[model samples]
Structures are given as C-alpha cells and as structure tokens.
Target: MSIEDRKQKIIAEFSMFDDWMDKYNLLIEMGKSLPVIDPHHKTKSNLISGCQSRVWLQARYENNRVYFTANSDAVITKGIVSLLIRVFNGLPPKEIIEADTAFLDKIGLKEHLSPTRSNGLTSMIKQMKLYALAFKTKHDSDKKED
Candidate 1:
C-alpha cells in the first residue's frame, strides 16, 4: 500500500480506540510485530542518540523505495519506532521528504510523549530523513555520472 493509504489506515485504527492508553498499547503491539535486526547491527553507530531507550535504526534503498529495520530496548519506545518505520518505510525519497508528520499531532502522539521521549522521537525521525536524503543524493549523483 502507498504511504498515504497506510497513514489513513493508521489514523483509522487509532480512531477505533477510545482512550489514549489503548492507542498507546496498540502502538507498542505494533512495535512487537517489527522484524528483528541482527545483533551486530545494534552497535553504537546504529543507536538513535538522545532516546531515553536504546533505539537502533537502519535503512536501505531498494527498488526505488526506502526500507528500514529498527529496534528498541524499551517496549514503548520500540512501538514509537515502529510507528515511524511504518510511516516512512517503502516510500520513495521524494515522497518521504514531502510527508508532513502533522498526523502525529492529530493522533496526539506528540502531545502524550514526555519531553525527553519527544526529543528522542524527533532524533529518530531526523535520522530516518537523513537516510532518505542520502539515498536521494546518491541516486541523483549516480544518474549524473551515468
């Protein structure tokens, strides 16, 4: 599915829950569903700095889209990472760049996260976007070389 469709689906799913706790629990559960990364990839270089929990993120470009794998030592943090992965994964560089995370505010994710947690989340997101930017730059440079 397209990222837009997935966004809508996520919004819809969150709407199904009446309480923030329920939604938060569902987000954590979503994190549980993320595929595991290799232990070797969990090094300090992969760690998302500023996160209260140890979070790791890795990205790769394939078939004109970006794919990511992530993990966190804390379950709730993992869930937050999963939400970010879902929102950004499989999107082309341009699309990923264009995406506005305003939905996060609408979903009350930003409001509910503690200040430190919010900072961590922001760091994680910036890292992911950097990956996208790097991919886009390399792709463009390669095309120029060709």
Candidate 2:
C-alpha cells in the first residue's frame, strides 16, 4: 500500500483510543511486536545519535526496496521506531524519501512524547531518509550506467 494509506491506517488506529494512557499502552504492545534486530546489527554503525534512549536502526536495499530493522533500549522508544519502520519498510527508496510524516502530528504522537524522545523520533526519521537517499543515488547511478 502507499505511504499515505498506511499513515492513514495508523492515524485511524490511534484514533480508536480516547485516552492517551491507553494509546501509550498500545505503543508498548506495538513495541513488543516489533521484530528483533539481529544481534550482529546492534553495533555502533546502526545506532542513532541524539536519542534519549539507545536506538539501533539498520537498512538494506534489495530489488529497489529498502528494508529496515530497528531496536531501542526503551519500550516507548522501540514503539516509536516500530511505527516508523512499519510506514517505511518494504518500499522503494524514492517513496520513502518523499513521504510526508505529518501524520505524526495527526496522531498526536509528537505532542505525546517527551522533548528528548521527540528529538529521538526526528533523528530516527532523518536516518531512515538518509538511507533511502543513499539507495536512490545508487539506483540512479546504476540506471545511468545501463
């Protein structure tokens, strides 16, 4: 599905909760459901800087798609990253690069986070885009060479 559609689905899901605490519990559940990253990928290279919690993100480009795996030391932080990965994973690099993340505001995720966690969320998004940019550049270059 398109990023917009997936984002809308997330918004709808979040809207189901009238209470922020319940939403937070949902986040924790989502975090628990996030796939565990390979221990090998839990290195400094995959670690995102500026997060109040330790977050490790890894991406691979395959057949024009970017697959991301991530983990966080904090459950809430992990949940945030899982949400990001759910929106971003298994898509072409250009799609990921161009996605509008305003749905974050729509779901009140940004307002709900602590200042430090908010910064961490921004950093996670930045890194995901950076990976996509790299894959896009490589794809463009490969096309030009053909």
Candidate 3:
C-alpha cells in the first residue's frame, strides 16, 4: 500500500483505542511483530544513538529502493521503530526524503512520546534517511561511472 494509505490505516487503528495506555500496548504489540535481527549485526555501525534503549538499524538498496530492518531492547521503542520502518522502508531515496512525516502528529505520536523518546525517534528517522541518501549518491555515482 502507499504510504498515505498506510498512514490512514495507522491513524484509524490509533483512533480505535480509547486511551494512551491501550495505544501504547498496541504499539508494543506491533514491536513484537518486528523481524529479529541477528546478534552479530547489532554492532556500533547499526546502532541508533539517542534512544534510552539499544536500537539497531540496517539498510540496503535493491532495485532502486531502500529496505530497512531495525531492532530495539525496549518493546515500545521497537514498535515505534517498526512504524517508522513500515513508512520509510522499501522506498526510493528521493521518496524517503520527500515523505511528509506530519502524519505522525495526526496519530498523536510525537505529543504522547516522552522528551527523550521523541529525541530518539527523531534521531532514528534522521539516520534512516541518511542511509537512503548515501545509497542514492553511491548508486548515481556508479551509474555515471558506467
């Protein structure tokens, strides 16, 4: 589905919950559904700094799109990361850069997050976008060289 559609779905899901606790529980469940990343790959290179929990993110380019996998020691944090991955993963670099993350506010995510957690989320998003930019640059350079 398109990112816009996914955003709507997420907002709808969030709307179904009566309180923040329920929403948080749902997010935690979402985190549990994230794919397991192997222990060896959880190195400093993949580490997502600024989070209270240890979060690791990895990205790759395939068929001109970027794909990502992430993990976190905190279940809620992992769920937040999972949401981000769903929105940003497997998209072209330019698309990732241009994405309107304003939908996060509509879903009451940023407002509900703790200051530290918000910072961590921002850091993770920035890092993920940076990875996409790097891949785009490398891919373009290789094409030019060819």
TM-score of every candidate relative to the true structure: 0.91, 0.93, 0.91
lDDT of 3 by residue, 5-51 (tens): 88888889888987889989989988987766677888998998788
Q: Which should have the higher TM-score, number 2 or number 3?
A: 2
Residue pairs in candidate 2 whose N, alpha carbon or C atoms collide under 3 angstroms: none
- Model 1 regions lying over 4 Å from their true place: 112-118
Ranking by TM-score: 2, 1, 3
Worst 10-residue lDDT window for candidate 2 reads 110-119
Better structure of 1 and 2 per TM-score? 2
Better candidate number, 2 or 3, judged by lDDT = 2
RMSD (CA, Å), each prediction: 1.7, 1.7, 1.8
Evaluate residue 146 in candidate 2 and report its C-alpha lDDT on the 0 to 100 scale.
100
Regions of candidate 2 where Cα sits further than 4 Å from its true position? 112-118
Worst 10 residues of 3 by lDDT: 110-119
- 1-146 per-residue lDDT for model 1 (tens digits): 88878888888888898898998889889999886667878888999888767888988899889988989989887887888788888899988877877777767686534456445877887889999999999999999999
lDDT of 2 by residue, 12-117 (tens): 9999998889888988888987767899999998999988789999999998899998899899989989999999989999999898888888787866344564
Clashes per prediction? 0, 0, 0
Local distance difference test values of all predictions, in order: 0.83, 0.88, 0.83
